[model samples]
Target chain A: MSSIVSRNLKIYFRDKSAVFFSLLGILITVGLYFLFLGDTYTDGLADFNHPEIFMAGWIMSGLLSITSVTTTMGAFGTMVQDKEKKIYKDFYCSPIKRSVLTMGYIISSAVVGLIMTAVVLVITVVYLAANEAIVISAMLVVKMILLSALTSLSNTAMALFIVSLINSEKAFSAISGVMSALIGFLTGIYIPVGNLDEGVQMVVKCFPTSHSAVLFRQILMENSLNEGVKSYPAAAQAEALAEVKDVLGVVFKFGETECSAEMSLLILVGALVVFSSLSIFTLNRKKTA
Target chain B: MNKIVQVTSLKKSYKDVHAVKGLDFYVEEGKLFAFLGPNGAGKSTTIDMICTYLRPDSGKILLDGSEVGKNDDEIRRKIGIVFQDSVLDPILTVRENVTIRGSMYGLHGKELKEAVENACEVVGMTDFMKRPYGKLSGGQRRRVDIARALVNTPKILFLDEPTTGLDPQTRVNVWNTISDLQKQNNMTIFLTTHYMEEASDADYVVVIDDGKIAAKGTPAQLKEKYAGNYLYIVPKNKDSLLNTLKKNKITYKQNIDTISIPIVHTVDSLEILDKVRENIDSFEVIKGTMDDAFIGITGKEIRR
Candidate 1:
């Protein structure tokens, strides 16, 4: 595992264009956020108005979605390139377990996503600090990183699945673009779920991206556990949301909540396992085909 | 000698096209076996199956007596493959690529380092160890690829058109490296090449045409079997010589260039030699080559 990780890190660091594009993505997200909402903050933490919250949520959600799409694109694109060059054949023929290949790519892509997410976090924190809206906490930083990594894994898995079904880069690109757009729009990245009809909001909630956006927004907005819980009507909805918030808050240093962080951690970890298994199954199909 | 690899009735199809049609062959241990075939004759398909990259549609493969399908991981551990296409990671340095491949075989730390160094040395790539693989010349990259495969010290190595696009000089260099590795390690090698010269160096050669075995034997044996001894030629302009041979009732096959007679004894009779010299503008005898044998057996020239 360490060998695979080290090798992936080496490949990731070697490509200057990949690094530049990733940084550019983070910069654009941050720059857009500040351009729209930087001047809105007033006096301390009380300045959390609807538009300020909306912009903050938008920046977080948009950045996360872009990071997810870009990381998936880069990871699967590299895989396709490797396939074309027959590099995957060399690696596949080696004694390394297929699980190692899957994990190595996922972990490397997650790292990139984490890095991009960090850039956004730093930019947002700095802007917020400059505006004197709120003080940035180390706990929030940790939550953002963990959530970003999870989202990256999910995205990478989806990309791997897409790559398995097609053999051409043009087709992969077209599909990836369409899928990313749909995922982004459906997850309420461009338009807030609050602005959309309840039916549309219900449709959005069916996707993992919608859940990820909500989770990310909660983490970035510094929303309290009680405040988050009260927004849910049903007991189960409140319980699930409270549980997730507790896990996010505990990992990052947010206020205490009614649920254990272990449960939320399990959910994220479970999602990783499920998605990774799906990716591996897809990889097997490709190899056997 | 023990059979190192056995493939029985292997079949692979890509949709409607049958790539390999019920192919069967076995390679003995420590022998350099050459699979000679034209393009799309299932050479790569066979190699891919043996390396466990492509699963066969039917039949079975046994490597060193263990079923390949049942134990793909073990099979993979014992075999090293150099693909027809370049497989080197362009983003990695030469040394890094070797080390990573070695590590996959459970080598690491000093062992991995030493293996990488030795493989580089063997391929004459020591000087370019630090160079990124993408930056190297094509020949250099191929050498690195060879080193990467060798780093694991596999029991069997598969070379799929190893010198397909290389220049003459680089091809020779690559062959030399492979030869040295074979001699020093006593590794069983399965090589697929279109080049007759490459096939000539192998201990055994299997000529495949249209996904079936055209012939299989050592170079000398194949030449002897398909190419008859002593091709006698009568020049076109030597009408008297041809008439003399005809009057003598000498049996021969006539083509545009000359009339050929397959004979057991040498053309050393003075009377026959003098008649030929007196009437013929020119005449010559030449031994046949493997290329001729391939043409004789397959009834078609091996296309480039």
Candidate 2:
């Protein structure tokens, strides 16, 4: 299985175009936010001294989350291409277990997701600092590191579930395009959850990745949120923060139940368990020609 | 002879189509076995089941005395297959492809490297082992695939139409490789091909069609049993040819392209041609062959 994992990693890296194209998804997302969407978003959050950093933090976290997804989806392309070319026939008939093959895909995809996300994190931190935004503390930095690992893991699991149902590299590319585009809307990076209608906001809160994005906003935006409210009267500031928290998915709502940050973390964990099991179950039934 | 494989009452179906109805055959140790059939004749389906890639509807298959579906991993460890289509990773070098296949068989460290090297040496692919698989010619590509399969040191090597599309020279190259592997390593080979001439070298031949065995025997035995020497004549006027042969009481069979008269006497060959000379466009004394045996047994053309 380790051999299979290493083989997948080698194949993915050897195809320089595939690595570039996979990162292309997140790169395009960043370009769109900067060239067209960033100033529009910054202008709305004028109450803060560095609304640019506040918006950058929110968008950058969303970029990291979606980068894990598209990159991992690219990693699974090796598996899909093998199936397409009938290379799996040799592997399937060999003295190797199907579970081992599945593990190969999962492990390689997790590694790619984490590596690319780390690159995105570094650039983001440097960019925010250059703009004289609120600095990231060592404690928040530690939390981001842990969250980066978890986000990659969950995204790999989720990608595996989606990829197992697909059998062609062409179909994978088409679906990845749709998924990459939907990421911005779902994460509320394009439009704040506060600006959206109640119905649309509910949809955002329901997605597991949106919960991850909300976690980043709570921590990275913590200082900016506090700074925005310092000039308000005490009573008005408290009420406004409460409303902001609910609207921005800082606390997810299930009909009448408002979920805390710890509950959202539980959702990420649940997604990991559910998607991993689902992918494995589906892969066991997969028939190779 | 020791039986390397024993199959009984094997059957398989895909939805409404029954690909293999009932299959039963055994391969002997250190010999080449041929599964011969035309396209859509269930040749691949039977091979797939025998290699444990597909499950049979109901059957008992034993590889080296272990039940196939029951002892899958054990059987897999003992057998290796070269698929009809090349299955190597195009971007990967020959060494990487071979080593990965070796690792699946539990080879590691020095043992794995040695196996890959030995297999490449066996297939004469050592010079090109560093090249990417996609860059090799059709013949070289297949040799690399053979090396990858050989790295496992399997007891029985299954070649699924191993030389189907190569040029005559390259086809001979692959066959020579197989023959040498069998002689030196004493590896048992079970191959499937529709080419009758290719199966001539096989020790045992099983002809399958419409999900059943059409015929089975040694190539020589089949020729003796189903076909006999005959004189072939292509006549322009069928009625005149039939009348001439019938009036002379010559035993013959009428086919689409030619009329064939059994050659009971070697000296009578010229006389038979002489009798049909007036009505015939061409004539020849056709020696019986494995192809004729196949046509005789199946009552259908072997080649499409």
Candidate 3:
């Protein structure tokens, strides 16, 4: 495992384009956030108390999801390149196990996600502190970083599953693009899901991205459970609180308008495990086929 | 000699086309066996199946007396394949490629390093160890690939058209490297090529034509059986030479300016030589070559 990780790291370091794109994602997210909120701040700090300002932070979190998609796109495309060059044949014929190859690719993708997440987190925290909107605690920062990593794992697994099914690069790009667009639009990354038709909202809610984006928004925009739940209205807020209680069970007491951080984290972790298992199963089946 | 590899009734079809018909052959241990065929003659398909890259539709492959299809991993561990196309990573250096291949065979640390060094030395690639594989010339890249396969110290090696696109000098170099490896390691080699000269040097040769075994024997035996000893003549006046041979009842086969007749007796040779002396420009009495045998047996040109 260490050897695999070291080899992946070495390859990653040699890829200047990959490093540049990672930094590009970070810069784009920071630049867009500051551009929109630059005029609103009195001095150098953001006003997190304002409803519009808080919503803007949520929008920034949704945009960060694009980075997750981009990371997977690059990693999966590299896999295709390896196949074209017959480099995969060398590894396949070796004594190395198939599981190791799958895990190595997934872990390397997760590492890239972690790096991008850290960049976004550091810039957001420093920017928020400078604007005097809110102070971030070390514990909250740790939780946010862990959530980011989980989100990355889930996205990478999804990409791996797609790659296992298809061998052509053009087909991979087309399918991954359609998937990213659908997930992004359904999760309200570009347009608010609540503003859509009632039927559309119902359809979007069934998607994992809808739940994931909601959880991420809760973390980045509102630090407290009460503030997180206040984004919705009476009936929806009550339903969210009930779902949180069901997930928490014996962990925490559920108030009239409150969400549970531990419950959201559990859902993310579960989704990651299921997607990763599916990806591995698909890869094994393809190998025999 | 003990048989090291046996392929029985091996068959593979691609959609509507049968790439490899029911084929059977065996390789003896420590022998250099050559598979000779033209383009699209199923040579690559056979190699691919034996290397476990492609599964056969119906057949049994035994390597060292163990069934290969049933024990693919073990069989693969004992065999190394150098594909017609380059398979080395362009981003990696020659040394890194060798080390990674060695590690794949469960070697590591000092053992892996020494194994990689030995493989490089055999392929004469030690001086270019640190160079990026992509930076090297085509022949150099091919040498790196050979070293990569040898790093595992496999019991059997497969070379698929190993010298196919190389210049004459580079081809000689590659062949020399292969010869040295065979002698130094006592390795069993299975090679495929279209060059008749290349096949002539093998310990055993199998000629495949249209997905079937057209002929199989040592170079000397094949020449003796399919190609009979003959006297060749290139006459200056083709019409007069043909008239004389036909009028004299001389049994001969004519192809353009060349005419060949079987050696029946030395008594008739002086009479025939004198009769054609004025009309003929060149004449030779020599043994038949492998090319002649191929043409005689297959009844088709060995198109590249």
Candidate 4:
């Protein structure tokens, strides 16, 4: 099984074009933030203290969420390519069980997701530090690393279930293209969930990736949000943070109740379990021609 | 001889099409066995069932003594297959592909390294082991595929249309390697091919048509049963030869100046030669070929 996983990793990283395309979603988000969205958010919140740092936190959180989805999808493309080329037939002829091969694909994709997300996190942190936007904390750094790992695992399962249904490279490419185009909206990066229609907001909130984006926002934007609200009275500061969290999608609400960070974590875990089971069932019954 | 594989009344169907109908055959250990059929004649279906890639709808497939699906992992460990298409990773080097396949069978470290090198050597691909699989020519890629299959040191090796797309010379080279693997390693070889000449070299051949076994025997037995040698005579005087044949009531087919007589045995040709010597200018005896036997048993219609 490890052999299969290592083999997948070698082939995936060896293709330079695949690696670049996987990171393309994150690059696009960064470019859009710098060119347009960054100024728009800062100007709108000019009265708030340190609006630039707070908005940077928001965009970087979205970047982290999108990284897990895109890199893992790219990693699972290796399995789809193997099926297209009928290379999976060769593996099935060996002594390894079908379940083992399935796990190999999932684990390799998870590893890729983790690696790419971590790289994005490091780069984001460095850019903020170089600009002297916010003071860095060791605990925050540790929390971000843990959050990246969790998001990768959750998204790996989702990617596996999606990839299991695809049998050809052409179909896989089409799906990947669609995912790359819509992931920003799904994660509330292109249009914040709070700013969209009530119906559209519910759809975004229901998506597990949206919950991941919220969790990342809660952790990454905590310090910046506190600093931005310092000008208000002590009694109003607490209410002001709540208002800002609602406005920026740092937390989601079903109707009247706000979704706690704990609830969002539960959603991520639930997604991991449900999608992993479905993927396993689908792959075991996979029939190759 | 010990039997390595046995299939009894094995059947498989795809929806309304019966791909394999009550097929029964056994392969002896350490011998070359060939399965021959036209396109869509169920040769691949049968091979797939035997290789445990597909399940038979009915009947039993036993490898060594264990039934299929019951002990498939054990059976898989003892057999290796080189599919009709090259299944190795194109981006990976030949050595990497072989090593990964070997590791799947539980070999690791020094053992895996040795196995990869030895398998490459067996197919004369040692020098090209470091090259990417896609970079190799057709014949070289084929040899590397064979080497990958060999890495596990399986007791039986299955090759499905192994030389279907190679040049004639390359086909011969691949055949030579397959022959050496069987001879030197005492491994049972089960293969399917469209080329009758390649099947002719097998110890046993089975021909199937429309999901049923049409013929199964040794090459010599099939030749004798379905194909007969012919005596072709180019007579100096066609009129005289025709009169003599008419008077003697001899069975012959006339094509212009030449007469073809089916020879049941060598002595029949000698007797005909002596009788027709007076009118004949030249005569030749053409031995029956596997190509003739195949066409004679399977008929001439094209299958979709």
* Best prediction by TM-score: 4
Candidate 3 docks with a DockQ of 0.43
- Could you tell me every candidate's TM-score relative to the true structure? 0.80, 0.89, 0.82, 0.95
Residue by residue across B46-138, what tens digits does model 1's lDDT show? 899988888899989999977877888898888888888887778888888888788888988998899999988988999998888999987
Query: Largest lDDT belongs to which candidate?
Result: 4
Q: List the residue pairs that clash in candidate 4.
A: none
Candidate 2: segments with Cα more than 4 A from true spot? A134-137, A167-170, A224-259, A284-289, B232-248, B252-260, B264-284
- The TM-scores of chain A alone, one per candidate, are 0.67, 0.91, 0.71, 0.94
Is candidate 2 or 4 superior in lDDT?
Answer: 4
In candidate 4 chain B, what residue range of length 10 has the lowest lDDT sum?
Answer: B295-304
Q: Which stretches of candidate 3 lie over 4 Å from their true place?
A: A1-13, A18-56, A63-66, A176-186, A192-205, A223-263, B227-230, B234-244, B253-282
For residues A15-64, write the lDDT of model 4, one tens digit per residue: 89998888778878888889998898788777679889888878988998
Tens-place lDDT per residue, model 4, B179-261, is 98889888999999888878899989999888889999999989887888899999999888878888888888998778998
Q: Sort all candidates by DockQ, best to worst.
A: 4, 2, 1, 3
DockQ of each: 0.59, 0.74, 0.43, 0.84
Best by DockQ: 4
Instruction: Specify the CAPRI tier of model 2.
Output: medium
- Give lDDT tens digits, candidate 1, residues A1-289: 7777777766766787765553454455456446653443212223223335434544555567456656555555566666666677888787777777867766666666666656666665676556443456787767766777776666566555666666766776676556644654576555455445667655754554455666665555545333334445566655555344332222222123222344444444565677667767777776645
User: What's the ranking of the predictions by TM-score, best on top?
Assistant: 4, 2, 3, 1
What would you estimate as the lDDT of candidate 3?
Answer: 0.71
